[model samples]
Target: MATGNETQVREFIFLGFFSLPNNPVVLFLAFLAAYLAIVTGNLMILVLVLVDSCLHSPMYFFLSHLSCLDICISTVILPKILVNFLRRRNTISYKQCLAQTFFLIGFAGCEPALMAVMAYDRYAAICRPLHYSLLMSKRMCIYLASAAWVWGFLDSAIHAALASQLSFCGVNEIPHIFCDVPPLLKIACSDTSVNELANHITSLFVGLFPVLFILLSYVCILASVLRIRSGSSRRKAFSTCTSHVIVVILCLGNGFLNYNRPSAGYSLEIDTLVSAMFCIVAPVLNPLIYSLRNKEVKGAFRKVLNKWTG
Candidate 1:
């Protein structure tokens, strides 16, 4: 299968933050701290959800899943970034690149669907309280969470398989920070129409559809909240949904900005910043948003803390 004058690309050199004005050590420290915070914050959410008796309901069930996803998504990208910063070289072997691409997309893809499921949970709670038990039974919650995980991995498999087939023709420099499909395709010497087509199609179904579902669910949630007669009851209903709404907006907005760059494309620094925001900052913020906004989560944390101290 050897082609004339064609060499295989075994590794890719990342031109990400290396060329930036800041010191690499400084960047590494900042990212390291951020990664720790992401892990700590999300881990707290996970433990509270699992151990707190009051958080056993469907809403917190879905929050636990989201917390897991945030940790996973950050792990897939940030560790490599930290290593690269310390090594003073940004490089990933071909196999490692593909693997990273697989898990990164898999975890990132799952969040939207999970959030949509959470929206449905909220919708069921507020819009159909009498039937909420029937609508979000324990078994139903498990099935929904399972489906979201499966959906993300299946989508990622398609892209990773297609990406593996690409012939880089000894061109292995990726313009972006991570091993994303778009940057890989840009540097690929082979025909990328298929990969591009697949990306576009998945963008529509995997990316856009879940977001639309979340929006519709929120619209219905808004209507239901407004219909509540008691001012206190209305405020309580709105408060429960507020954290989820802020998180969905933050995650989806960053994702949109990252993926939907102008056709001409931004400068490399801008591109890198956008990628960092999507992959790094978003994960760090998700737990913080929930912890600060939700009194229930705070109470859960306090209860656990007091027990430990006692």
Candidate 2:
């Protein structure tokens, strides 16, 4: 039995901000500016981390990876958005849509685990400063970072595989800006019980476990910081963790709010705005957050600037 929805839905048409004002030029300019800023900001961080010996520590290494992840996540979708604005075409092929969805899921999943690793790094630095070098050795950092990225890709593969098996025999219109698990699942005409269940399960792998680990590490970190006798020493110790905490909150708060929720609250406009926050806005903010808040990064930026100018 061939359902009409299954046979006809070969492509997806995105109704992107179409109902807002119907102005593609304004949208194109805005998105172009954002895309340029995100690329330049993240690229500066990447280049500095690579070139500066002062930033060769485990923290900066992980921060570089975080920068790379932000670049990747934002890049995966922004080009298409830019194309849509310029060409006035918001259509994505079935295969391309799935590929986009896969990369997005993989990168999004990697953040929590990477953040957890960073939390542990901070914990090791403050809670066990004497053992920081031995505990967070070069090999160990590579292993942890590699595991996070691999797990993210594997998790994304599983979800994409399952979603591919689904029969999207209904309308090919995705309510939001891009192709995503929940949005894709929303349009499926076939049984999505299994797919949705898989979506739920894989998300825990992506978000919950790592978040718990990060929280646990922070608790230990906070306890250790409290024991510092001098006010300046305490502030110095606490300052290192503060930016990470801010980033963690921004990442996890926006992330879990949408991905971790049930489908009952799904609104098209709301989802678009929220997705833009984490996907588009967060990446742009990450580099600024790291550079402005951390003295090391700021100092390194000054060194680089002076060296180049000289």
Instruction: Give the whole-model CA lDDT for all candidates, comma-separated.
Output: 0.89, 0.86
Q: Candidate 2, overall lDDT?
A: 0.86
For 1-310, candidate 1 gives per-residue lDDT tens digits of: 1156778888999887865876988898989999999999999999999999988999889989998999998898999999988888899999999999999889888988998999999999999999999999999999999999998998899999999988878888898889988898888888889998999999887799999999899899999899989999999999889898999999989888887887464788888888889887778998899889988889999999999999
How much does each candidate deviate from the true structure in C-alpha RMSD? Answer: 1.3, 1.8
> Where is the poorest 10-residue window by lDDT in model 2?
1-10
The local lDDT score (0 to 100) that residue 143 gets in candidate 2 is: 99
Those runs of model 1 whose alpha carbons end farther than 4 Å from true positions after fitting are 1-4
- Which 10 residues in a row give candidate 1 its minimum summed lDDT? 1-10
Measured by TM-score, how close is model 2 to the native structure?
A: 0.95
Clashes of each: 0, 2
